[model samples]
Target: MISVKNLYHSYNKDGKYQVKDVSFEVANGEVFGFLGPSGAGKSTALNILTGLLPLQQGEVVVGGYDLKKVSNERFNKIGMSFEQSNVYSKLTAKENLDFYRKLFDVPTLDSHALLKLVGLEGKEHVKAGEFSKGMKHRLTFARSMINNPEMWFLDEPTTGLDPSIAADIKDIIKEKNKEGVTVFLTTHNMFIADELCDRVAFIVDGEIKLIDSPKNLKLQYGDKLVEVEYMEKGEVIKTTLSTVLPEDKRELQKIIEHHDIQTMHTKEATLEEIFIKVTGRGLV
Candidate 1:
């Protein structure tokens, strides 16, 4: 659904670039995550794709139209939600979405349904300025779907929301993806990327370090170990045993047979750990 090759962007006219030599593709119905820390050029790349920033160099195509000469019809197939909420403060939640609905030439989703979908049913009549930060964020999310877009560009969609609300947002993204919306998600949150993305690209200092499915990445970089918490005497003991070693496996077998096991699970590398290992820096 989207393709970018050798993408580059610079804030100033200087030779240094914010986004450099970036390239990736998003399948028709895939959730492709662009993962990075602050100032790692995730936003710079996203802005270029969404047309917020002009294309400074390289090639980018969305829905088969080259960004260098893409027409307005192409944008109608795209939707975007930023980390910061961008809504008309004086307008009501319903009004905010209704206003955006008119911007598209294609058929749009119902404002009321979108508002309710994002947990803003009652707030339909409430002014956006009166709503809390979370409320405004939810409103922005609903507004993005106003066009019923095929390509969804989300920037930190659930960044500051509480767990419950974030879960709702994730569910909605999943639902949309099931309905064939191609999502380009930019985030620093490992959990979100691991949960929602079919594949992720790790970007650091404007260059991509790696791109792979979370499961594949974990298997490639994960430690061959199992973590166990079991009752020993009057207290609980927690330990890690190497899965690759015969001695540790035997000891783990003994624990399973004799001790009351409280919990036992494989100790695999998390996405954050893998990112750190690859880039020599944390997501931050």
Candidate 2:
């Protein structure tokens, strides 16, 4: 559904590139994440792909249209939710959606239903200026769906949301993907990427370092060991056994038979840890 090849962009004629020779693809009905910290050029790449930024070099194709030659009608198939709220502060939640529905030339959307879906059902009549940051974020999220777009571009979708609300948004994203909407998510939040993305690209300093499924990346970077916690002499002790160890099976059996096991788990690298290890920089 989306493709980028050797993409590069710079804000100034001689300035350093904001996005440098980055390339990746997102299949139909797939959720692809661009994971990076602020100033990592993830947003720059997204903007270029969405036709917000003029292409400087390379190819970017979305919905079968080249980024360099995309028409205004291309927006009909795309929806975007930015990190900052872009709705009018004076408009009510329902009004905000209503405005976007008309702006997008989408007459089939139910503005009230969209608001309700985002957890602002009763607050539909309240002006957005009075809403909390989380409320504004939810409203913007709902606005993005006003067009019932074929593809979604979400930047920090759950930025200001509480746990419950964030979970709700994530669930909605999953449902959309299941319904065949391709998702391009950009965020520094590894947990969100791990939960929603089918595959993720690690971007730093305007370049993509790696692209792979989270599960695959975990397996590639994680240890092949099992950690066992046991209680002995009123004290808790833990030991790790490499799965490849010559006596691993016998040792595990002995520990199970002689010790009171408290807990056991396999050691695996988290997406955040893997990113740190690969990029040599924190997500911030």
Candidate 3:
């Protein structure tokens, strides 16, 4: 649904780029993640794709229209939710969505349904200025869907939200994706990426380090080890045994036969571990 090639963006006349030599593609119904830390240029790339920032160099295309000469009509097919909430403070939650609904030429989702979907059903009449940060964030998220967009650009959609609310947001994203919305998610949260993304790109210092499915990346970089917690001399002993070694397998067999096993599970590399391995830096 989206394609970018040799994308580069510089913030100043000196030509120091924030996004350099970036390239990737998002399939028609795929949820693609751009993973990185703060100032790693995830947002810079996203801003350029969404037309928030001017195209500095290279090519970008969304929904088959060249970004360089894309029309306003093309924008109607896209929706965006930034990390920071942008809502009309004086307007009520319903009013906020109702206002955005008029901006699109396409049909819009119901404002009441959107507010309820984001867990703000009763706050429809409350002025946005009185809302907490998380409340406003939810409102902004709902507004993004006002156009029933085909492609969704989300930057840290669940950041700063409590666990329950974050889960709700994630469920909503999943539901939208199931309905064929293509997602371009930019986030430092590995768990969100791992759960929602079909494939992820590890980006650092404005360049992409790697791109693959989370399952494939883990299989490539994860260790073949089994973690065991067992009773040894009245104490709970926790250890890992390599699954690829014969000696380790014998040791595990002996433990299961002679020792009381408390817990056992395979240990695999997490997305963050793989990211660190690829980029030489943590997501944070």
Compute each candidate's TM-score over C-alphas.
Answer: 0.97, 0.96, 0.98
Report how far off residue 194 is in candidate 3 (Å): 0.6
Scored by lDDT, model 1 comes in at 0.93
**After superposition, which runs of candidate 3 have C-alpha atoms over 4 Å from their true positions?**
none
lDDT of 2 by residue, 1-284 (tens): 99999998899957689898998989999999999999999999989888888988999899888878859988988999999988899888888887777767545469888888999989989999999999999989998888899989998898868999999999999999999999999999999999999999999999999999999999998768889999889899999988767798689889899999999998877899999999999999
Whole-model lDDT per candidate:
0.93, 0.91, 0.94
Best candidate according to lDDT: 3
In model 1, which runs have C-alpha deviations exceeding 4 angstroms?
none
**Alpha-carbon lDDT of model 2:** 0.91
TM-score of 1: 0.97
Question: Which regions in candidate 2 have their CA more than 4 angstroms from the true location?
Answer: 247-249
Q: In angstroms, give how far residue 157 of model 2 lies from its true place.
A: 1.1
Q: What is the number of backbone collisions in each predicted candidate, taken in the order shown? A: 0, 0, 0
Ranked candidates, highest TM-score first: 3, 1, 2
